[model samples]
Target: MIVAAVDAQNLVDALGLGSIYALMAVGIGLVFGVLRLINFAYGQLIMAGAFTLAYASRANWSTWESIVACFAVVIGLSLVMDLAVFRPLRTQSPATMLVATFAVSFLLQSIALLTVLKVQGQLGMPASTVARLSQAVTIWGVDVRKVTIVSIVAALVALGALALLLGKTTVGLQMRAAATDFTTARLLGISANRVIGFAVLLSGLIAAVVAVLLTARTPYVQSDFALHDMIYVLVGVVVGGIDRLWTATLGGFAIGFASGVIYGALPTDKTAYLPSVLFALVIVVLLVRPAGLFAPRGTSTVERV
Candidate 1:
């Protein structure tokens, strides 16, 4: 009975964790597909959105209103970043762009800390929001947080919408073309700004979604709220296969699921070892499949999203 109970809880946690990471992966993969840049600053979008939520909560805004504000702030910031920073440096070396993103990440984190620390004693969301999200619902005699179900549903919906956007729409076609070959696509009349801007918009939207779910699971809105999570998702993208969206998504889910299982198995006091074990496993996987665990043998490490 004890083992069964533990396994059931682990399964729930795994599904929830996988769902969050999968959405994050899609956002990262979208930007990567077009720009070929790994955006470390992506987490700042979530941090900004979370802070928006925290502010809304402080103002006693309704839940729905807070959610809307969160999305707006994240998407708006995303556009601004792309237009002001990334657009100008489009032709720069990849290393330069990578460093730029890292700088942006730190800048945003510092800004968040400086701004929020004075307003609130520390960075955090409203107690009511956390209590509401942490509320448990029992299913078949097993208990799970309401947010877990929401996370899984949101992930499925986001993935489905992404598939439709990529497979059916004209912009989607342009995006795929750009991903396949940015220079060739531009020469073929696809607008570089439009395609790339739209990609950033989509990533920002995903970040907003992540902010909501993450805030619910962990209502403490800190400067580093999404930083470590983003790092894990990045690793997952590399592990699963960063060349294609599906592979990257699967990789994120795989890493999250593995982490969930390891976390569930560990004693509370030993939880700090989770990262050490997880990274070790990642190293082993990389040693075995340097291209990627999911990447096909002999294939080029590039593809359309």
Candidate 2:
């Protein structure tokens, strides 16, 4: 019975983590689809949202108000980034854009660190209002946090809504065309700026949602709140096939679920090595499926727009 209970708990936790990672993957993959640039600064968007929630909580704001602030901050910063950094660098080499994102990531982290130190004189802030979701309810003799269910449902709903946007909307068609061949799409009268802006908007919205869900699990907001998870999700996206969004999402969920299970299974003392073990497995998976584990067998490395 003890072992069975532990297994059940692990499964639930894995699914919860997987759902969060899947959302993160979608945010990354969406922008990648249109921009062809991997934004290393993506995590900072989540961090920004989390900080918004933290500040709101400190001010005793209503839940809805806090959520609104989070979305507003994340989305606003996303557009600023698109305009200030990405737009000018759009014509540059991929390496240049990639390095720029790295610089942006560090800059954002430094800003957050400095701002928090100056204002709060601390390295972290508690988003206590959103922490209520961490409370657990019993289900079939197992306890499950509300955030777990919310994460899973949110992912499904977001994905479904995105599908409709992409499949049924005209702008979605233009975005698809741009992703496939930007030069051709531009020649066909598609506005590159519009398509990229919409993609960044959608990505920022998803990041805000991820911020809420993650804060429920770990209510303390820090400069590096989502940084490590972003790294893992990036690896998972590549392992699952970054060229395609669906595969990249699956890759994110796969890694998150695997990490949860591995952590649960390892002895308490050995849990510190989880990253080493997990990454080692990732290396093996890449060796076996260089094109991506979920990608079609014959899929080429060529950009799949």
Candidate 3:
């Protein structure tokens, strides 16, 4: 019974992590859908929001106020990235734009590290206020953290709302068209700037939400807080099928869930090999389904919002 209970707890925890990764995948995939450029700096946006939350907590701000600040910082940074980097490089080759994102990512990390060092004389900050959510509640004789439940609910609601927006709203249709073919969409009078801006805005909003949820799970604020998760999520995106948003999201969740399960099953001393084992499995999956594990057979890599 004890072993069964432990397994159930692991499943719940894995579900929560998967939900968070799904949101991240959506954020990354949204920008890719519109720009045809992978924003490698996407994790930096989450880091920024996390730091903002840490700062707010340091200032003794209320939880709601800290959340608002996170949204503001993340969304503002997203727009600035669009205006400063993406807009200017709009006509550049894909390789160039990709390199630009890497540069931006490193730049943001350096900034965070340096700023924190100067202000706090350290590299990490404790978000004690948000960490309270990590407290577990007993359900069905198993303990589940409040943040786990919140993460699952948030992902469901956000994904549902996004579906409605894309299926039933004008701007969402415009985004879909742009994703399908930006050149043709513009020819049809859809505003390229507006569509791209909206994608960035929505991506940033998702990032902010992820920041809050992730910080609740791991309350330490650091420059590389979400860096590794972003890499894993990118892998999931590619593995699940980057061509479609839903497939990409599934990929993210699959990886996160697999990771959680693997971590739980491994002996404590042998856990260091988790990434190697996980990625080796990823290689096998890609070899078997190069188009994407969830992508339909014969499906082309055409972008879908």
Candidate 4:
């Protein structure tokens, strides 16, 4: 009975974590699917939103106001990034574009760190901004965090809406064609800039949502807040199968769920080994599957962000 209860709790936590990670994977996958860029700076978008939320909280803004501010800042930054850096290098070699993103990521992280230090002397967020998200609710004699429920629901809603956008909308069709083959897409009269811009916009929107949920869960709003999660999601993308969107989503969920289960099962003192174990598993999986754990055999499609 004790073990069952523990397992149940871990399952709940895993589901929540999986939801968050899946959202990230989708965001990263969207950019990659269309742009063929890995976008190492994607996490910085989330960081920007989190800090926006923190600033809004400090200003005594309402919840809705803070959310609006967060979204605005993240989306705005994403557009600027695409226009100023990514757009200019669209025709460059992949290595060049990849290195450019690495530089952007570092630049944004450094700027965020210095700005926070200058303003607050440390990384911080208003306590009230996240306190309610950690509150627990009872369900079938089990207590679960409200944020977990929100996270799962938000992920589902966002994914569903995104599916509609991609499946039913004209721009989404263009994105799909572009993802299949950018050169062909351009040949077919699709506007490359428009398609790329749409992908970045969607990616930024996803990042904004992630920022809200993660901030509510952790509330620290630190400089490196999303960096570690981004790394895990990136690895998950590769492990699941970067060539396909569904596979990447599954990979993200799998990693998040595995992380939760392992963390819950570990002795508290030894929890620090979680990353080492997870990465080691990733290495083993890569060694065995080479392509990806979720990728179909004999598949060889040129893929990307």
Candidate 5:
């Protein structure tokens, strides 16, 4: 039997899978790039959206409505996470921020676990999210789900809009400023707090989209899914390098495609070997280009907004 072969369907799957991975990766990278601390709770943002979608489905809300509402809710959750977990810990150290995020992640996961099924003698969540995808589109006569199409489109549109927002808007200007040198930007009278808050908000929003799309692909939201999948996203960030937003995005897709292809050919028992594959990829890239594959975070030449 042939071990490896290229096909159109394979290409589509890789791209669709890669785009979502990129979406997850860039958001994770954003938190790390600025704060230089891992947001372990990052995946919780996705889980929050999944749970929101699950509940909204019970109301028979349209998919579009549910998605939009989930995004908004998660963004609000991020603001709260920032205020509650991150802000006070700012003066401690990067490790403290990491620990705080991990705590948030665990707490959120516990909430999901305890609510995965109907709570007896209590309110039962009537969520109808068992299936979120319907039809499959054919590319050269190969089947791919419509949700995959929606994911690709939504990711492109959302990410493109964000690119323009960061590149063109005044608030975006401040964000780019804070990312470069938080202390120096603060000296320029730019409210680093606000800028960082905006970044966290963006992270929540992006993670929500990623979560919903991935949830659509799953049978149900499991407590361990977000924490486990998050490592893959973080792998993209590390391999891709987090100096710039685009780097994280591109790196994410590349990592996704690479992982998908490799996983496709591997036996179930061998699946656990992928991380080392990705880690080696990252190590090689860092060795060759420490700043990352894309350009480093741009310097804040413009005055703070």
Candidate 6:
């Protein structure tokens, strides 16, 4: 009975962790699906959303008000990337474009790191959120936060909206045609440029959602990501297969479970190994199935607007 209860608790935490990873992976996958670039700067996007909210809150803006501003800034940022980097890169070779995206990601990271450094002397988590995370409810013997519930809910809603946008809308249809074959999408008069713009916009929106949920759950945003969380996110998507959104989602849960189990079993001193294991898993999965677990089945993702 004790073991069963422990398993149940592990599962709950895993679900929470999975949802967070899924949130990040959704935007990352979407961007790659359309643009074929693995952007390392995605974390900076999350950081931007948090810092934007943090700044707004400090300026006496209401929380929701800050959220609105966050989306606006992220969208503007996306538009800028589209207009500048991606547009210019499109004319270059694939390897060149890939390098350009990496460069852009690095630039964003540098800016984000410096911006946060200037605003806050030390980088860890914000002092404000720790107190906010104190309250929680126990369900199924699991002590879960309202923030986690909210995060999972937001992820589901965002994903549903993405499905509608991709499957039901005319723009989504055009995006589909474009993803499979860009030249044909352009030849068919689908306005590939517009579709690409929308994809970037979508990525920004997803990033925003992830930012909000993650911040809420962490009760604060940390400027430094200690590689483990980063690797965990990568593992979830690669093992689940970026092409299969649901599989990626499921992989997030799987990873979360593995993480919880490992963390629970490990000595506190060696806990850092968790992320390295995740990284190894990701590498192994990449070696075995670079396309991902869901891609072999040819499953396409449909998220609502």
**Could you tell me which residue pairs clash in candidate 3?**
none
In model 6, what lDDT does residue 73 have?
76
Off by over 4 Å in 2: 1-6, 302-305
The true-versus-predicted C-alpha distance at residue 174 of model 2, in Å, is: 1.5
| C-alpha lDDT (0 to 100) for residue 22 of candidate 2 | 94
Model 5 misplaced stretches (Cα beyond 4 Å): 1-3, 58-61, 117-134, 267-273, 283-291, 294-305
RMSD to the true structure for each prediction, in A, is 2.4, 2.1, 2.3, 2.0, 4.6, 4.4
What does the lDDT read for residue 304 in candidate 5?
18
Clashing pairs in 4: 32-305, 37-305, 38-305
- Give the alpha carbon lDDT tens digit for every residue of 1-305 in model 1: 32443688888988898899999999999999999998899998998998898888888888888899999999999999998889999888888888899899999999999888888867654524434777899998889998899989999999999999999999999999998888999999999999999999999999999998888888878888888888889889999989788889999998988888778877888879989988998999888887678888865654322
Global lDDT for candidate 2? 0.90
User: Candidate 6 on 1-305: residue-level lDDT in tens?
Assistant: 32443565566666666777777777767766666665566776767777676767667776678778778877677778778988878767667777776687667766767776787765533523223443578987778877667767877887798789889999888877776667877888888678888888888887777666666656455554323454577667767866555666666656766786666556678877867766776778767666665556544433310
Model 6 local distance difference test score = 0.68
Ranking of all candidate structures by their lDDT, best first: 3, 2, 4, 1, 5, 6
Error of 2 at 240 (Å): 0.3
Provide the lDDT at 75 for model 2. Answer: 96
Task: Give stretches of model 3 more than 4 Å off.
Answer: 1-6, 301-305
Residue 261's lDDT within candidate 5 is 68
**TM-score of model 1 (CA atoms):** 0.95
lDDT of 4 by residue, 198-248 (tens): 999999999999998888878878788789999999989899989778888
Look at candidate 5 and give me any clashing residue pairs. Answer: none
Q: Point to the candidate with the largest lDDT.
A: 3
Tens-place lDDT per residue, model 3, 1-305, is 32443488788998999999999999998999889888999999999999999999999999999999999999999999999999999988888899999999999999999998998999899887687789999999989999999999999998999999999999999999988888999999999899999999999999999999999999999999899999999999999999788999999999998888788777788889879988999999999998799999998655422
- C-alpha lDDT of all candidate models, in order: 0.87, 0.90, 0.92, 0.88, 0.74, 0.68
Model 5 over residues 1-305: C-alpha lDDT tens digits?
11465466666766777878888886876776567667878888887788787777867888788878888888988899989988888878777777788889889887877776554223233335536474587766888887678778977987888889888999888777777787887899988687878788888878888877777766355566666668777767655666567877888888887776666556678878867777788788767766566646543222211
